[model samples]
Target: MAVNRACHLIEELGCGTVLNGMLDYYPTKEEVQKVTVNPQRINKLLGVNVPMDQFINILERLEFKCNLISSDKLELEVPSFRLDITEDADILEEIARIYGYENIPAADLEGNATAGVKTENQKFMDKVKENSIACGLNEILTYSFVSPRGVDKINLPENDEKRNFVKIMNPLGEETSVMRTTLIPNMLNVLATNVSHKVEEAYAFECGNTFTPQNGLPVETKKYCIGMYGKEVDFFSLKGIVETILNNVGLKGYEIESETTNSTFHPGRCAKVVYNNICVGTFGELHPDVIENYNLGQRVYVAEINADLVFENITLVKRYSALPKYPSTSRDIALIVKDEVFVKQIEDIIKANASDILESYKLFDVYKGSQIEEGHKSIAYSITYRSAEKTLTDEDVAKVHDKILSELSEKLNANLRSN
Candidate 1:
């Protein structure tokens, strides 16, 4: 059978040697001084008309033994398994695959065609993956090389600078030896491998690049991590899907705050997603020993974000307003305060004292227990009070909502939860 298909193409090309039985290939005066060949680079890469004695009769009918070495090169020899004929356009694609690309001749394709626009950081990461797939998430794409026990399974902290990473000196083991400096421990190990295959309710998300080892090179960044689990994933349902992917990346005044130094989150259910003032990421409820080190039986809720600081603080030009012709007056209030008062310090004391018909305020409700007292906590907000030239009544929002409930009762001593 043709010597068993030439001994399976000389043992699939690792062709060492095989004398009398026929398959002896050698070539190594530095692979015959690196097999040169240039009849004008085989007539400018096979556009054909290959002359110089038909390119030295197609290198002596492919037994390739050439020699001339320079009035335009030629040295040839190659055959220790023809290690991909090193260069000169791989011997002009092996002379257009043995000079029979139907005798070559198909030109017309030389220039001007352009029409491919996207950059503005790829249209702001495609509108942050179209608002994280319209909020139901599911994008996941893990492994920017992980597992240095993912910073001790996200318990991180012993001098945590995300446990300073970037190892992989030749890793293909020890669980991919390092590089990911946080993408929520591989998006909580892919939502704990889709909740161990039965997938109760995921939501996942990831938009990559994390590395951080600076100074010896490796700075990467561009993040966005998100995760979720079922049984109503908490921490305000992943802070309303990280404020709808930072309002689909056009970001804007951002601020979330409450995070207490990140031992992989959950210290008071976490927060910190600031903006113009930088911090740009962190969302909570995962640290129950990082959900039992990823066994993840429900309740996950995560968020990473800093998608390069929301692509350098987004808002790529947009300014439209003019539709308030009056009619807004909401007002709810409720206070009682002291569990270390911070509803962004009572919305920065109703935006530093009702800066004119307040028009927005939210925290719907947040009580503590037994009608609230021992160390206190009752919250509740609602506010809104608009006017673009008319109609905000209820005594025009009760005199700036009673001077924002009298400066949340004289600077956060709070107390007003009666009826």
Candidate 2:
């Protein structure tokens, strides 16, 4: 629904929390170092001035040694039991709590309160979820941190970039020991679980983040994925799902071509989604080895989209135009090309030669049988012609139609289907 730059951000005014703070923590075993405390800073922060003597007395009663090194500063030795008092802010909060928080009269909050609203990127993802749900996919969420074994499970190569994992120094367990570079493993795990539970079929999607290790930091990239395993699932059905999302996002001049090299997917069944010559996604049925690795009994299909790429390229502004007033004419043509010829190749020829009056064309049928020659196939299309200035006569439409057929014959060696 919208385009967003960078990751979603919150411009908090007075928070001291660092975004890239360390996750690893090691508690001291022997003793905590003495905290450098300032009574004036405590008072300024808490907005209540208490005399230094009173501060020292209150801490002493709590079994703390407040050795005054300056008029306003003290080298405070915390009680052995107060192991949490390792930082000055911790000691300040303790003083406030002991001084009775109810006694400090509350003042009006500073500045204006910012009303929470969804970011444009957040709204776009929400739209993706809704549209996917309408297409009959159940929304599912999986953990960002997953086992390192996932890379192996998918049979990624040794030099694959996904093998560069952001390992957790203190993970929950071995299963959650590394940040995910791809959602394929998680999706496979989900589909595998459903089969284990004896579910007949599953169609699920996730719009989430994938972490890529970049220059010793985990860079968050948004990803959208769909996984399905059922008697109803097939390559073309999954392709339809992909096309629906692409059109819904308003992309143009995109290409879907065959892919064969990815180890995770079945060769010849996989295809990449490219827009403006940039590959934004890959989708296909699982390789037989992958199916065995996941212990899945049924064939599975998966699709992954670099949603960050889509977010960057999507155009939210839609133009409007009135319906055509003049009558439109239609033409049905069937042509035969070699077995190796792609539908897009024929379409390219038609589009290149068609005149301005050619409004649209749709593939109505494709035939391969005894009536057709071996090592070739027959394809049919219903072409429409119209004019903005006036209704197109049969003679006018025929000239353009003949021109397109001539080009197809010349460029692709296509023959008209007589049967």
In model 1, the runs with Cα more than 4 Å from the true position are 1-121, 126-143, 155-182, 185-245, 248-282, 285-302, 305-334, 337-359, 362-373, 378-382, 387-390, 395-419
Candidate lDDT values, in order: 0.80, 0.87
Q: Write the per-residue lDDT of candidate 2 for residues 270-297, one digit (tens) a residue.
A: 9999988899999999999999999997
Q: TM-score per candidate, in order?
A: 0.34, 0.70
- How many steric overlaps does candidate 2 have? 0
What lDDT score goes with residue 362 in model 2? 87
**How do the residues 1-419 of candidate 1 rate in per-residue lDDT, one tens digit apiece?**
88777777897897855445655475744434357766775787566677667777776787777777565778777665577677678778777777778889888877997779877897888888888888888787877887778788888878878788889899989888888887888888878888889978888788988888878789998888888878767788788878877876778888888988788877887888887677888888877887888888656878887787777767778788877776886878788888877788889888888877777888988889987889989988888878777777677678778887887798878978995
The prediction achieving the highest lDDT against the true structure is 2
lDDT (C-alpha) at residue 237 in model 2 = 79
> What's the count of clashing pairs in each model shown?
0, 0
Clashing pairs in 1: none
Shift in Å, residue 220, candidate 1: 18
